[model samples]
Target: MLVISGAVQAGLAGIPGQSAELGISLTVMGSALAAAGWLLTVGWRFTRKLPKPASDIPQVEQGIRITPNIIRVVVIGAVLIVLASALFIPQVGFPDAFPILGMLVGFLWSVAAGLACTGRVMKTGRVMKNSADLYARWLSRR
Candidate 1:
Protein backbone atom coordinates (compact mmCIF):
# COMPACT_ATOMS: atom_id res chain seq x y z
CA MET A 1 0.00 0.00 0.00
CA LEU A 2 2.82 2.36 0.87
CA VAL A 3 4.58 1.55 -2.37
CA ILE A 4 1.41 2.19 -4.33
CA SER A 5 0.88 5.44 -2.44
CA GLY A 6 4.41 6.53 -3.22
CA ALA A 7 3.82 5.78 -6.89
CA VAL A 8 0.65 7.89 -6.76
CA GLN A 9 2.49 10.80 -5.14
CA ALA A 10 5.21 10.55 -7.77
CA GLY A 11 2.57 10.51 -10.48
CA LEU A 12 0.94 13.64 -9.08
CA ALA A 13 4.12 15.59 -8.53
CA GLY A 14 4.17 19.18 -9.86
CA ILE A 15 0.99 18.89 -11.89
CA PRO A 16 -0.49 22.39 -12.24
CA GLY A 17 -4.20 23.27 -12.31
CA GLN A 18 -7.26 21.32 -11.24
CA SER A 19 -7.80 19.69 -14.62
CA ALA A 20 -4.29 18.32 -14.73
CA GLU A 21 -4.47 17.14 -11.15
CA LEU A 22 -7.80 15.47 -11.82
CA GLY A 23 -6.40 13.60 -14.76
CA ILE A 24 -3.39 12.47 -12.77
CA SER A 25 -5.62 11.39 -9.92
CA LEU A 26 -7.73 9.35 -12.30
CA THR A 27 -4.64 7.66 -13.67
CA VAL A 28 -3.44 6.85 -10.17
CA MET A 29 -6.86 5.50 -9.24
CA GLY A 30 -6.93 3.24 -12.27
CA SER A 31 -3.42 2.00 -11.68
CA ALA A 32 -4.16 1.24 -8.04
CA LEU A 33 -7.30 -0.65 -8.99
CA ALA A 34 -5.33 -2.70 -11.47
CA ALA A 35 -2.68 -3.46 -8.91
CA ALA A 36 -5.32 -4.58 -6.42
CA GLY A 37 -6.72 -6.95 -9.03
CA TRP A 38 -3.28 -8.38 -9.68
CA LEU A 39 -2.62 -8.85 -5.98
CA LEU A 40 -5.90 -10.69 -5.51
CA THR A 41 -5.04 -12.93 -8.42
CA VAL A 42 -1.66 -13.71 -6.92
CA GLY A 43 -3.20 -14.52 -3.55
CA TRP A 44 -5.67 -16.86 -5.20
CA ARG A 45 -2.90 -18.64 -7.06
CA PHE A 46 -0.87 -18.99 -3.89
CA THR A 47 -3.76 -20.56 -1.96
CA ARG A 48 -4.40 -22.85 -4.91
CA LYS A 49 -1.00 -24.50 -4.54
CA LEU A 50 -2.19 -26.33 -1.46
CA PRO A 51 -3.45 -29.92 -1.81
CA LYS A 52 -7.04 -30.59 -2.80
CA PRO A 53 -9.57 -32.99 -1.37
CA ALA A 54 -10.15 -36.38 -2.98
CA SER A 55 -13.80 -35.48 -3.41
CA ASP A 56 -12.87 -32.79 -5.92
CA ILE A 57 -14.63 -30.10 -3.87
CA PRO A 58 -13.37 -27.10 -2.03
CA GLN A 59 -14.36 -26.65 1.60
CA VAL A 60 -14.42 -23.49 3.63
CA GLU A 61 -12.25 -23.17 6.71
CA GLN A 62 -14.36 -21.82 9.53
CA GLY A 63 -12.42 -20.35 12.45
CA ILE A 64 -11.59 -17.19 14.32
CA ARG A 65 -8.23 -15.54 13.80
CA ILE A 66 -6.18 -12.64 15.19
CA THR A 67 -3.03 -10.60 14.66
CA PRO A 68 -0.94 -8.13 16.73
CA ASN A 69 0.91 -4.84 16.40
CA ILE A 70 -1.33 -3.61 13.61
CA ILE A 71 -3.57 -1.02 15.26
CA ARG A 72 -0.90 1.64 15.55
CA VAL A 73 0.12 1.18 11.95
CA VAL A 74 -3.48 1.41 10.85
CA VAL A 75 -4.21 4.51 12.90
CA ILE A 76 -1.13 6.22 11.60
CA GLY A 77 -1.94 5.21 8.06
CA ALA A 78 -5.50 6.42 8.42
CA VAL A 79 -4.39 9.81 9.69
CA LEU A 80 -1.92 10.10 6.85
CA ILE A 81 -4.36 9.11 4.13
CA VAL A 82 -7.03 11.39 5.55
CA LEU A 83 -4.59 14.28 5.71
CA ALA A 84 -3.40 13.70 2.17
CA SER A 85 -6.91 13.31 0.76
CA ALA A 86 -8.32 16.29 2.63
CA LEU A 87 -5.49 18.40 1.39
CA PHE A 88 -6.30 17.37 -2.15
CA ILE A 89 -10.09 17.80 -1.98
CA PRO A 90 -10.22 21.59 -1.60
CA GLN A 91 -7.82 21.88 -4.49
CA VAL A 92 -9.93 19.45 -6.47
CA GLY A 93 -13.37 20.71 -5.51
CA PHE A 94 -14.77 24.14 -4.70
CA PRO A 95 -16.67 22.97 -1.60
CA ASP A 96 -16.20 24.12 2.00
CA ALA A 97 -13.26 22.29 3.54
CA PHE A 98 -14.98 21.54 6.85
CA PRO A 99 -17.55 19.08 5.48
CA ILE A 100 -14.95 17.36 3.39
CA LEU A 101 -12.64 17.13 6.34
CA GLY A 102 -15.37 15.62 8.46
CA MET A 103 -16.20 13.08 5.80
CA LEU A 104 -12.59 12.11 5.33
CA VAL A 105 -12.04 11.81 9.06
CA GLY A 106 -15.10 9.63 9.46
CA PHE A 107 -14.01 7.31 6.68
CA LEU A 108 -10.52 7.14 8.10
CA TRP A 109 -11.84 6.21 11.50
CA SER A 110 -13.93 3.32 10.21
CA VAL A 111 -11.43 1.77 7.82
CA ALA A 112 -8.37 2.25 10.00
CA ALA A 113 -10.05 0.94 13.10
CA GLY A 114 -11.52 -2.02 11.25
CA LEU A 115 -8.26 -2.99 9.58
CA ALA A 116 -6.25 -2.57 12.76
CA CYS A 117 -8.63 -4.70 14.77
CA THR A 118 -8.63 -7.32 12.04
CA GLY A 119 -4.85 -7.41 11.92
CA ARG A 120 -4.64 -7.64 15.69
CA VAL A 121 -7.07 -10.49 15.70
CA MET A 122 -5.06 -12.33 13.06
CA LYS A 123 -1.87 -11.95 15.08
CA THR A 124 -3.08 -14.30 17.75
CA GLY A 125 -1.19 -17.50 17.00
CA ARG A 126 -3.91 -19.78 18.31
CA VAL A 127 -6.57 -18.31 16.04
CA MET A 128 -4.58 -18.06 12.81
CA LYS A 129 -2.89 -21.41 13.33
CA ASN A 130 -6.25 -23.02 13.92
CA SER A 131 -7.57 -21.49 10.72
CA ALA A 132 -4.55 -22.64 8.77
CA ASP A 133 -4.80 -26.08 10.25
CA LEU A 134 -8.43 -26.34 9.27
CA TYR A 135 -7.69 -25.18 5.76
CA ALA A 136 -4.88 -27.67 5.48
CA ARG A 137 -7.17 -30.42 6.61
CA TRP A 138 -9.74 -29.50 4.04
CA LEU A 139 -7.11 -29.32 1.34
CA SER A 140 -5.74 -32.70 2.23
CA ARG A 141 -9.21 -34.20 2.23
CA ARG A 142 -9.69 -32.90 -1.26
Candidate 2:
Protein backbone atom coordinates (compact mmCIF):
# COMPACT_ATOMS: atom_id res chain seq x y z
CA MET A 1 0.00 0.00 0.00
CA LEU A 2 2.70 2.45 1.01
CA VAL A 3 4.86 1.59 -1.98
CA ILE A 4 1.96 1.87 -4.45
CA SER A 5 0.72 5.10 -2.90
CA GLY A 6 4.24 6.61 -2.96
CA ALA A 7 4.92 5.49 -6.54
CA VAL A 8 1.55 6.74 -7.78
CA GLN A 9 1.98 10.08 -5.99
CA ALA A 10 5.47 10.58 -7.46
CA GLY A 11 4.24 9.59 -10.94
CA LEU A 12 1.23 11.89 -10.75
CA ALA A 13 3.40 15.01 -10.43
CA GLY A 14 1.65 17.97 -12.11
CA ILE A 15 0.20 15.56 -14.69
CA PRO A 16 -3.50 16.33 -14.53
CA GLY A 17 -6.88 14.74 -15.44
CA GLN A 18 -7.19 11.22 -16.93
CA SER A 19 -3.66 10.07 -16.09
CA ALA A 20 -4.24 10.85 -12.42
CA GLU A 21 -7.47 8.82 -12.41
CA LEU A 22 -5.64 5.98 -14.16
CA GLY A 23 -2.82 6.15 -11.65
CA ILE A 24 -5.31 6.08 -8.77
CA SER A 25 -7.05 3.06 -10.27
CA LEU A 26 -3.72 1.29 -10.73
CA THR A 27 -2.75 2.06 -7.16
CA VAL A 28 -6.02 0.63 -5.85
CA MET A 29 -5.73 -2.57 -7.90
CA GLY A 30 -2.06 -2.97 -7.03
CA SER A 31 -2.80 -2.57 -3.35
CA ALA A 32 -5.55 -5.20 -3.55
CA LEU A 33 -3.24 -7.66 -5.31
CA ALA A 34 -0.47 -6.96 -2.82
CA ALA A 35 -2.81 -7.59 0.09
CA ALA A 36 -4.10 -10.84 -1.45
CA GLY A 37 -0.54 -12.03 -2.17
CA TRP A 38 0.55 -11.19 1.36
CA LEU A 39 -2.38 -13.11 2.81
CA LEU A 40 -1.64 -16.10 0.60
CA THR A 41 2.01 -16.06 1.63
CA VAL A 42 1.18 -15.71 5.33
CA GLY A 43 -1.00 -18.85 5.51
CA TRP A 44 -4.45 -17.35 5.06
CA ARG A 45 -6.89 -20.24 5.58
CA PHE A 46 -9.37 -18.96 2.99
CA THR A 47 -6.69 -18.86 0.35
CA ARG A 48 -6.81 -22.66 -0.04
CA LYS A 49 -9.64 -24.96 -1.01
CA LEU A 50 -11.75 -26.32 1.83
CA PRO A 51 -11.60 -30.04 2.41
CA LYS A 52 -14.86 -31.97 2.03
CA PRO A 53 -15.79 -34.27 4.88
CA ALA A 54 -16.73 -37.72 3.59
CA SER A 55 -19.41 -38.11 6.23
CA ASP A 56 -20.98 -34.82 5.24
CA ILE A 57 -21.84 -35.89 1.70
CA PRO A 58 -24.91 -38.14 2.19
CA GLN A 59 -27.38 -35.52 3.45
CA VAL A 60 -26.53 -33.27 0.54
CA GLU A 61 -26.95 -36.09 -1.93
CA GLN A 62 -30.35 -36.95 -0.49
CA GLY A 63 -33.08 -34.29 -0.54
CA ILE A 64 -34.79 -33.15 2.66
CA ARG A 65 -38.21 -31.68 3.46
CA ILE A 66 -38.70 -28.11 4.68
CA THR A 67 -40.18 -27.61 8.14
CA PRO A 68 -42.54 -25.02 9.65
CA ASN A 69 -39.60 -23.25 11.30
CA ILE A 70 -37.99 -22.80 7.89
CA ILE A 71 -41.21 -21.28 6.55
CA ARG A 72 -41.25 -18.79 9.42
CA VAL A 73 -37.63 -17.81 8.90
CA VAL A 74 -38.24 -17.42 5.18
CA VAL A 75 -41.14 -15.05 5.81
CA ILE A 76 -39.14 -13.01 8.30
CA GLY A 77 -36.19 -12.78 5.98
CA ALA A 78 -38.49 -11.73 3.16
CA VAL A 79 -40.02 -9.01 5.32
CA LEU A 80 -36.62 -7.78 6.34
CA ILE A 81 -35.49 -7.76 2.72
CA VAL A 82 -38.61 -5.86 1.66
CA LEU A 83 -38.09 -3.30 4.41
CA ALA A 84 -34.46 -3.01 3.46
CA SER A 85 -35.50 -2.35 -0.15
CA ALA A 86 -37.99 0.26 1.01
CA LEU A 87 -35.15 2.24 2.53
CA PHE A 88 -33.68 2.67 -0.94
CA ILE A 89 -36.92 4.02 -2.40
CA PRO A 90 -36.83 7.69 -3.43
CA GLN A 91 -39.69 8.61 -1.11
CA VAL A 92 -37.84 7.08 1.85
CA GLY A 93 -34.40 8.02 0.58
CA PHE A 94 -31.54 7.79 3.05
CA PRO A 95 -28.08 9.01 2.05
CA ASP A 96 -26.27 5.82 2.95
CA ALA A 97 -25.64 2.27 1.69
CA PHE A 98 -27.17 0.79 4.83
CA PRO A 99 -30.23 -0.42 2.95
CA ILE A 100 -28.11 -2.30 0.42
CA LEU A 101 -26.06 -3.79 3.21
CA GLY A 102 -29.18 -4.76 5.15
CA MET A 103 -30.65 -6.59 2.19
CA LEU A 104 -27.56 -8.81 2.02
CA VAL A 105 -27.61 -9.40 5.76
CA GLY A 106 -31.29 -10.31 5.67
CA PHE A 107 -30.82 -12.75 2.84
CA LEU A 108 -27.89 -14.47 4.51
CA TRP A 109 -29.77 -14.61 7.79
CA SER A 110 -32.75 -16.24 6.10
CA VAL A 111 -30.63 -18.87 4.42
CA ALA A 112 -28.63 -19.64 7.54
CA ALA A 113 -31.68 -19.69 9.76
CA GLY A 114 -33.55 -21.97 7.43
CA LEU A 115 -30.57 -24.30 7.25
CA ALA A 116 -30.08 -24.40 11.01
CA CYS A 117 -33.77 -24.92 11.65
CA THR A 118 -34.65 -27.50 9.01
CA GLY A 119 -31.51 -28.36 7.10
CA ARG A 120 -32.98 -26.65 4.06
CA VAL A 121 -31.79 -23.80 1.84
CA MET A 122 -34.34 -21.37 0.46
CA LYS A 123 -34.15 -19.01 -2.44
CA THR A 124 -36.91 -16.50 -3.17
CA GLY A 125 -39.56 -19.13 -3.81
CA ARG A 126 -37.60 -22.33 -4.19
CA VAL A 127 -35.97 -24.68 -1.72
CA MET A 128 -32.72 -26.43 -2.53
CA LYS A 129 -32.91 -30.20 -2.19
CA ASN A 130 -29.50 -30.52 -0.57
CA SER A 131 -29.02 -30.58 3.21
CA ALA A 132 -25.46 -31.88 3.39
CA ASP A 133 -23.99 -28.44 2.96
CA LEU A 134 -26.30 -27.09 5.63
CA TYR A 135 -25.47 -30.01 7.95
CA ALA A 136 -21.78 -29.39 7.36
CA ARG A 137 -22.22 -25.67 8.08
CA TRP A 138 -24.14 -26.50 11.26
CA LEU A 139 -21.38 -28.85 12.30
CA SER A 140 -18.76 -26.18 11.66
CA ARG A 141 -20.70 -23.66 13.72
CA ARG A 142 -20.87 -26.12 16.61
lDDT of each: 0.49, 0.49
lDDT at residue 105 of model 2 (Cα atoms):
49
- Tell me the spans in candidate 1 whose CA falls farther than 4 Å from its real position: 1-48, 51-114, 117-126, 131-136
Worst 10 residues of 2 by lDDT: 120-129
What TM-score does candidate 2 get on C-alpha atoms?
0.23
User: RMSD, model 1, all Cα superposed?
Assistant: 10.0
Residues 1-142 of candidate 2 have per-residue lDDT tens digits of 3334434443543233223444456457767887888877786555555554345343543424445455566667767775866665565343233333333444455455546544434232132334456657867886
- TM-score for candidate 1: 0.32
lDDT for position 87 in model 2: 68
Give all TM-scores, in the order shown: 0.32, 0.23
Runs in model 2 deviating more than 4 A are 1-66, 84-92, 102-106, 109-142
